[model samples]
Target: MQSWLDVDPTSDFSIYNLPFGVFETRDRAPRAGIAIGDYIVDLAVLAERRLLPLPDHAPHREEDLQRALNRPTLNDFIALSKSVTGAVRLCVQQLLMASSRDAHPPEVWAHALVRQRDARMLMPLRVPNYTDFYSSLHHATNVGAMFRDPKTPLLPNWRHLPVAYHGRASSIVVSGAPIRRPRGQIKRDDDPTPTFGPTLALDFELEMAFVIGKASPLGRPITTSEAEQYIFGLLLFNDWSARDIQKWEYQPLGPFLGKNFASTISPWIVTLEALDPFRVPMPSQEPPPLPYLRASGNQSFDIHLAVDLIAPSGLTLTVCRSNFRHMYWTMSQQLAHHTVNGCNVEVGDLMASGTLSGPTPESYGSMLELTWNGRNPLRLPDGSTRTFLEDGDAVALRGWAERDGMRVGFGEARAQILPALDGEA
Candidate 1:
């Protein structure tokens, strides 16, 4: 996909990927836009200018598309049928294509293009609900062996289903927001009683989350085959953890304050159309899934994921390198299990593939597993080491799907750890 835009050959936002996001100009309200290169093409502006290369038999109305694009979130646009989304994306692609650029008027580029750096990125959608799934077999097993019995690392139901817990959607934030060290109940290994204070074992989990595009009726379950249509696209996710607080609180009920404090996500939501070329066959399930969970075709994406740890002085270390395709359970299986009980999914709902650690120790997703709960520390580039995140430590998560010289990337989800509030009850 050649484009008139001057995009770097290695850039994540290649012409092939017109990933969507919400951005605000200095004086204007937030609007939906697509990443083309170093610039963002405002969909609303394009629609307002009547520049969309819409076909005569387009299924959706131009006015509706304009209204949806003018909104602060992409929910309405994504909620449209796949055909509509595909048509819009195709129109954008054609307009930007270098060969076709000569055919369009100059005003097409003038009104729609905005410098990427000048735009203030906002949350692409209002996430109605969030769920983090323990879908990575290696990540689950590695953590289980460290905390539970090494021999019986996986839980009984892990092999049969995608183990997951409802997450706090309200606390989720877009990338670049500062993360305060959360204060929660922590019981020292040597101490009998638990105390409330700032967590010392703060960590980052590298992950990828998908946004829901289509909504299902309340009591109707979306089958595995039907799940893909409901999915919008993927983004980088960081599930920050309070390991000390979690250790004491997780068994009885599951993650609460330890995880609810913050979860970071990249702004750009790469559409599924951009990722179709990177899809790969999912790993075989030894104990075959139930009828509803079984999926037939290529369901996993070969997205390369990595994490960088930066110290206060700017020393950086690429601590963990992993791949999304390494996960044993596919996204389809996760979504199937999520709605198998008649629970409906809504547009803009976020579902994360929890901690995508690969088959090697070097691919461990979180500090808890990478440092083995502080027994082994990771040495940084400047001789500093990390057991878990410390005050002023910054963590960045990056992901991209690349094949045959084309790339579709989620820029980055980054946050710096700040000191806890002075006083907390």
Candidate 2:
């Protein structure tokens, strides 16, 4: 499909991938926008002019629809149900296609568009809660082999369910936000007592998180087949970690101070409809999951993921490359397991697929794994090496799925490491 707009064939926001996001200009307030090529189609403007298309199931009054689009976050718009959001996506897709150009003149249509460079992207939604799952078999295995017995890399219960922990939602930030290296309790193996200082090992975990669009009843559970319907979209996620703190504190309880500092997500939320073409079968789970977690066929996406390290010298190099399809536990299984205990979820709640590492060393997703927990250091272009992040070192994660010359992707989730606060180091 071709668009009348000047969208390069290589663009992630193709006519087929009309992802939603929030953006604001210096003069305008934050509001919902649809990404297409190099421009953001302001939904508020289209709704104000009655140029926005709505399905019969949507609110009849144009003003009501306009209010939903002009919110500070996409949560309200997402809560409108996929029935409404799905039609809106399809309408926006058609609005861009060359064959279905609207009857309005070019100048009238141009008023609703804004160049991507002129606007600042904001968090697409207010994240009410976050859950990070250890779903990657390879990543878990690597961590186990490094810190635990190499002969038994996996725990006994790992194959039965998705291991996860509640994350700090308030710390989640949009991409481009700088991450301050957190200071916390650090106890080395040789140390007699725990020490409090700036983390010596700061790392980034390449991940993908799905946004929950619908609220569920407190006692009701979401089944595997019903999980995707409740998920509005997906985004690239960087779960920043303070490895030194985690090693000392993570034991009976999962990540706390080590992980609560910050997590970065891409601005755009790529809808599941746009990613339907990239769905693929998940890696087989051994020992098989319980009845509630048994999901059939194509539960994982074939999104290609890459991580790049940007040195202080401005040199950038791709350090890791992996695929989301190799995940042992599918997102459906994660959701099914998450809510099986009657835990209710709401709109804007995020569930992240843990670090997506593949079988090869080059595909390891985190600095801890890529460097074998600091045993091996990665050589950067500046003639420096990194076992973990340094001040001014930035981590950028990119994800996309391309087929038949069409691409659908999360633009990027990037953040630079900042030195710890004064008196804290």
Candidate 3:
């Protein structure tokens, strides 16, 4: 589909991928925006002009629809039915088409379109809850070999169910935010006693997270076949980790201070409808999962994932190249398992596919696996080496799927690491 605007075919936000986010200009407040190439289509202005599909599934009053899009987050707008949001997406796509240029007034187009560079993209939603799942077999196997018996890498229950933990939704931030190195209890392999200080091993986990568009009642399980109805879209996620703290605190219980420090996500949420063409069959699961977790048809996306690290010296390096298709467990399975015990989910809740490491050294997702737990260091182009992140280092995660000359992507989830605070935590 050709847009009237000059959208580079190689741009992540091509006409085929109109991702949604919240943005604000100097004179405007936070409002809903649709990204296409280099511009942000303002939903508030479109609603005010009656160009968008308002009142069809939303408030009857056009002003009310405008007000809803003018909010600080997309949660309220997403709480509406999928048909409503789907209509909005289709309407915007139609308006941007080259053939439809003469159908709309120039004044209306001028007011509704804004360059992305002129606006600030904010967090797309207010997350009610966040769940992080260890669904990548390679990542789990690598971690197990490093810490557990190499002969028996996976735990007894791994192949049966998706292992996951509830993460801190409050700490999640939008891209370009700075991540402060967490200060916590650290006890190395040789240290007799645990000490409290800045983490010696700080890492970033490359992940893809899905947003829940609809809510489910408590005490009811969202079956595998029904899980997709609740999922809204996907976002690139960077779940930061403090490996030293994780090793010390994660025992009978799961991670605590080791995680929950901070995580970064791309501002835009790419809708599943935009990514439908790139769907692929999920990897076959051995020892077939229970009925509740069994899913039919294509359950995986062929999204290519990569991670780049910028050193303090200003050199950038591609440290990891992985794929979402390598995940052993699918989103359907994760959501089904999560609610099988009666855990209710809310709109805007996030569920992340844990580190998506592939079957190679360069495909490892986290520094823990890439550097083999700080033993093997990655040498950068500037001759500097990195086992884990240091102060002023920046990490960015990018994901995309392409076929038939079309690309749908999550632009970037980038963040710089800041020095620890003056005092200790």
Number of the top lDDT candidate: 3
Off by over 4 Å in 1: 53-59
- TM-scores, each model vs. reference: 0.98, 0.98, 0.98
Give model 1 RMSD, 1 decimal: 1.2
- For each candidate, the alpha-carbon lDDT, in order, equals 0.89, 0.91, 0.92
Write down the RMSD of all candidates, one decimal each.
1.2, 1.2, 1.3
Relative to the true structure, candidate 1 reaches a TM of 0.98
Instruction: Give the number of colliding residue pairs in candidate 3.
Output: 0
Error of 1 at 296 (Å): 2.4
lDDT of 2 by residue, 351-383 (tens): 999999999999999999999989999997667
- The global Cα lDDT (0 to 1) of model 2 is 0.91
Question: Model 2 — which ten-residue stretch has the worst lDDT?
Answer: 56-65
lDDT of 1 by residue, 150-267 (tens): 9999999998999999999999999989999999899998998999999989999999999999888887888888889889899999999999999889878999888999999999
Clash count for each candidate, listed in order shown: 0, 0, 0
